[model samples]
Target: MTGGVVFDPLLPWPLIATLGLVALIGVTLALWRGLSGWALRALAAIALLGALAGPVYRVEDRKPLSDIVVMVEDASASQNLSDRPAQMQAAAEALAAEIEARPHTELRRVTVPDGAGDEGTRLLETLAEALAEEPQGRIAGIIALSDGRVHDIDRAPPLPAPLHLLLTGRESDWDRRLIVTNAPAFAIIGEPVILTLRVEDSGAVPQTANIAPLEISVDGGAAQRFEIPTGRDIDLPLTLPHGGRNVIQFTVPEAEGEITARNNTALVQINGVRDRLRVLLVSGEPHAGGRIWRNLLKSDSSVDLVHFTILRPPDKQDGVPVDELSLIAFPTRELFLEKIDDFDLIIFDRYKRRGILPASYLENVANYVRQGGAVLVAAGPDFASADSIWRSPLGAILPAEPSARVIEQPYHPALTDLGQRHPVTADLQGEENWGSWLRQIEIETTSGDVLMQGVEDRPLLILDRVEQGRVALLASDQAWLWNRGFEGGGPQLDLLRRLAHWMMKEPELEEETLWAEATGQRMRIVRRSLGDEVGAVTVTRPDGKTLDLALEQVAPGRFEALYDGPEIGLYRLQEGDQKTVIGLGPAAPREFEQTIATGEVMEPLIAPTRGGILRLEEGLPRLREVRAGRPAAGRGWIGLTPRDAYETRDVRQTPLLPAWAMLLLAAGLITGGWLREGRR
Candidate 1:
C-alpha cells in the first residue's frame, strides 16, 4: 500500500570518486582545447555513474491505542467506621465521570474486597492484578481512593505512570480501647494471680472521670466492686475458687457521655490447677494397707499429710494403767468437726467402730461428705466383722456395705470397664510396671464405680460421688507390700497422689472438659479425660459463630487442638455437654476497628499528589484534564500522567533525485558550456 526511496550502492566510494575526477578532467580539457563534443561526452558519462545508486519511495498508515487509567477503591471495615464509605463512593462516581469524558482515555475500575478474615485490607494486590492485564505503555496513571491502612502493602507493583491517593476521614478522628496487658493460661486454685490491665483514653474523651468503678466476676457469679484510676495501668490479684477453666469477666461501668461501652467489659479465662493438697489420714488400727497409704501420701512433696494412729483402746484393761500407757488422746471432735473443712481429703485406713469416736461424731463426718467433703475408706478384715465402721452413722456415706464374707486369694489388681472410662481410674489400665496386690477384702455394693478387681473377680477398689463430695473405697488390706518393695513394687506414690487429688474435686478429674490456653495469637485447645472415646468438639468464636471439629487423642486421657484466633476476643469451646470459654485477644484490643475504608490512613500519601482530599460530605468534583506532567488541578480540571503510544503499518519517504534524469541534464549543460568556450 505504500513505498519510499532507499539506497542500494553496488561499488565502493573510492571507485566512485575516481570516476568523478576523470569526468571533471575530461570536461576541463575539452573546454580548454576548444572541443565542445568532447566536453558533452564527459558530462554524459558522469551522470550515468550517479544513476547506478538505488532509491525508492515508501508510505504507511498507523492506528493509535487508547491510554488506560486505573481507579482503585477501598471500602473496608475501618472505612465504614467513619463517614469514609460515602466519601469513597462519591469520589469514585465523580472520578469515573471525569475519566469517561476524556478523549482516547479508558478507565479501569478495581474494587478491593475486605481482606480474608481479620487480615485487614488489601488494595495494592487488586491494583497489581488489574495492571497485568493491560500493556504498560497504555497505562496513564493509577488513582486510589481509601484510608492509607493497607494490610498488603508488599503487593504494590512498580508503576509505569504516576500513582495518586485520595484519602478519607477527618483530621480529628480518634479511638479508645481496653487493653489486657497480662493474663496467665494457668493459675493455682484458691491462689491469687496478678492480672495487668489498662484503660486508655484517646482523642477527645467527653467525660474525664479520675476513678472508674470496675466490676469483676468469676464464672458468671455476682461481680465484686473495685475502683481503678482511669487512663492508667492497674494490677489486680484474683483467687480462683475451683479448678478447670475459670472464666473471669472484668467490666467498667459506663460513664456519662462515653463514646462507646463495647470496650468496657472484657472476659478472661484462666485454668485453675492445684499447687498443693492437704490430706488427713486417721487409722483406727495398724494394718499393712494402712501403712501403704501413709507412705504413699507422705512421699509426695505437694501433699501435706497429717497421719494419726490409735495404738490403744479406751476401755481396754491391761497390766499397765491408762496413764502409764503414754498414748496421746486422739482429739476426735476437734479433727472430725472443728477442723474438718481445713483438709481437702480425709482417709479412714482400716478404721473400725471404736469407743473413742462417738456416734454423733461419725454422723458429723457423714454430713461432711454430703456437704462437698472428700472421704476415702480403706477396708480390712475388720470391715466384715461386728466392729465394722459401716455399722456407724458414717455408714450412710460409705460407697459399699461390708458383707460377712472374706475372700482370701492372691490376685492382680485390674481396671473395670467403667473405671477405664472414668478419668481418675482409666490411667491405671494397661500399666505394666505395677505389682499386683495379693490380698483383697470382699464387699457388696449397688452403687459406686468399681475401679479395680482382685483374683476371682472380687472388687478391690470402688469410687463414687454423693452430692458435691467424692468417695474412694479400697477393699484390699495388703497393698503395703507394693510400698515396701516386697516384690518389685512400683509407682505406689504416683497412684495414691492421683487418687487423692482426684477425690478433692481436681480440674484434671473431669472426664470431659473443654479448655483453651493462648499465647498471643496461638491457642491450644486441650480436653482431659478418663474415657476411651469422646465426641466431636464445637468451638464458639467471639462473634458467637460455632465451629465443629473432631479432636485427636494425644494420650490415654488427653485430647488437644491448636488454633490461631483471627481477632483478639473471647472464644468458647464445647464437646458434648462440656463447654468452656476463654479469651484469645483482649476482650477488646485497642486496635480492632471493624471498618475497612482507608481514607484516614491514606491522607499522608495523598498529600504528595497535590490532590484535594475532599469528603463525600461535599459533592463529587467533576474530572478535568491539565498538562500531562504539570499541575493537574489548577482551576477545575484534574491531571493525568500521559502515556504516548502510536502504531504504523505503512510509511511514505521521498528521494532527493533520479539518476537517469540527472545524467541527461548534466551532459547537456557541459556540452553547452564547452561549445561557448571554444567559440570565444
Candidate 2:
C-alpha cells in the first residue's frame, strides 16, 4: 500500500499579487490623505483573506497491478533450417521462466508462424496483436526471439515500454542459396530463352572456389552439363523443343565445401508455345471437309495457314493448244525443296501425281520428313488408283500401301484399339450422337497404327512415326460430313485441334510421360498413355523424398492423382521412365534471404526509445524501476521500465464542513472584532 498528500488548489504568485491590489484600492479609498493606520489594517485584512481561500491535501491508499511482459517467438520455416530451431526452443523456455519469476508480472507469449507462399515471417504483426489486449500502463518490456528477418517491420506497434531482442542463431552459421534473377512465364517453342541465375554464399563463405557443373534438363531427360562460376551470377540460354508447359530443372553438383544443398537446384515451368505455325495445304480438288479444315485452322490467331487448290494439272491438254491455257506453272520445286524448312506442317489433300511434280521433288519431300519435319496425307478414292502419289518416290516413307479398291459405303468413322488410348483420337466417345461419313476409301495399311476405322473395318485414319518426324493418314477424306453435320456431328473443332497439337509433339500426347499441375496448394499428378494400363507413378518433392503412387484412370487414357504438399516449394514427378520438375511457390522469401541473428533490423526502433537489446547468449538483464517517460536503460546497459498502476477495488468519498458552518464562523469573528475595537 502507498499514500501521498496532494494539493487541491495551488495558485501561482500572480494571483496572490492581484488580491493585494484590491486591498490596496480599498485602503486608499478609506484614507486618501497619507493614511498609515488604514494601510496597516489593509495589509492585515489581505493576509486574513489569503488564508480563507480553500486549499486541501488528501492521501489515498493504492495497490499496484501486475506488470505485463511480452515474449515474441519466431516459428517460421527458416527457424527450422538448422540448429536454430532447437536454439529458439531453448531460449523461449528460458525467457518464459524468467518473466514468470518476476513478482506481480504476467508473461504474454506471441508466436510468429511461417508466412503463406513465400511471404516470409511476420514478427511485428504478432507483437502488435498481443499488445492490443493488455493495458499500456501495465506493460513492462518486450522480448523477441527470432532470426531478425521479419517481413512485417512496418507493423511494429509503438513501444509502451522498453523493447528487448534475444536473437536466436550463432555467428558462424552460414547459408548458400540459388537465385533466379530473370525468368519468363512464356517462351517461343524451339527458340532459346535466356535465363539469369546465381549461386550466392552468405555468412561464412567457403574458401575454395569449387565451381560446380550446372546440369539442365527439359521435361526430365538426360541433362546437358556446363561449368558455372561460383559465388556470382551467370546467364544461361535454354531452348524448349515442344509446346505446352515445359518443365526445366537446373541443378549444380553439390560443392564439397557448402552448407546445404537445398539451394543447389532450381525448377522453372515456362509455357512453350509456337509464335506462329506455318502450314501449307495443297488440295487437288475442292471438297466440303477441305474447306472445314481451312476454316478451323484459319480461325486460330496463332496459326498461319496457306491454302492452295489445283484447278488443273500441267499434263492435262484439251483440244485447245497449250498456248491457249492462261494458267501459270506451279512452283513445285520451290515449295517442296527450296523453302521447305520454313513451313512447320505440310498437308496433301487428295493430291495425285500429274507430272506436275517430278519423282525427284517427291523424294525431296520424303527427305524433309526424315529431317524433323511433319507431314500429313488426306487421301480420297484416287489414292487407291493408278494416279496415287504413294507410287512415287515418297512410297518408302509412306506407312500404308493403298489397295486398288474403292468401297462406296456409308459408315461411322470409328476409333481403333490404339486410337482409344492415343491423345489425339482418345476419349472422343461420340456414342451419344455418333456421326456418319457419306464416303469411305478402301486402303490396306500393314505397318502403321490404325487410329480411326470406317466401313467393314477399313482403316480411316492411320498414324505413323517416321525418321525424326510424324505422319498422319486420313483414308476416307470424307471428314467434311462431320463438319456439315451429316448425322448429328459433335465438336469437329476439338478433333482437329487435338490432332494438330499431337502432331506438334505436345508433351501431354506422349504415350508414357509424367506431368504435374498445381491448383491452389494441391498438385494433380497426370500420366497419359496409349496403352490400356500404365505403371505406378513416382513423385519427388522439393524436400527430396520419392513416393510411388498407383494411378487411377479418370478418362479413357488419362490417369491422375492428387498430392498435397506440406509447404510451398518445388516438386518433381516421375511415371514409368519419364520425369518432370515444377515450382509451386514464389522464387524466394524476405526472411530466408538472411538466416543469421541480428538486431540491425530493429535498431531504429531501439535507438529512439532508449531501449537496450540483449542477446539470450549474453543472459537476461535484471528488472529495474525507473521514472515514467525516462530512459529505461542508461549508457551501455539494458533494463526494463516499470509502470505504477493502482487498482481501486473500492473508493470512499466524504464532503465535510457545509457553507452554513463557514458563514456562522465569519459572523462570530466579526462580532468579537467590533466589541474589541469599541473597548479600546
Superposed on all Cα atoms, the candidates' RMSDs to the truth, in angstroms, are 8.9, 4.8
Clashes of each: 38, 1
TM-score of 2: 0.84
Using Cα atoms with residue i matched to residue i, what is each candidate's TM-score against the true structure?
Answer: 0.69, 0.84
lDDT tens readout by residue for model 2, 69-177: 8888889877776677887788778767877998888898889998776678888888888899999989888877787778887888898887767667666666666
lDDT of 1 by residue, 281-327 (tens): 98877765667777778777878888899887776667786677667
Leading candidate by lDDT: 2
Superposed by TM-score, candidate 2 places the C-alpha of residue 288 at a distance from the truth, in angstroms, of 4.7
lDDT of each model, Cα atoms only? 0.73, 0.74
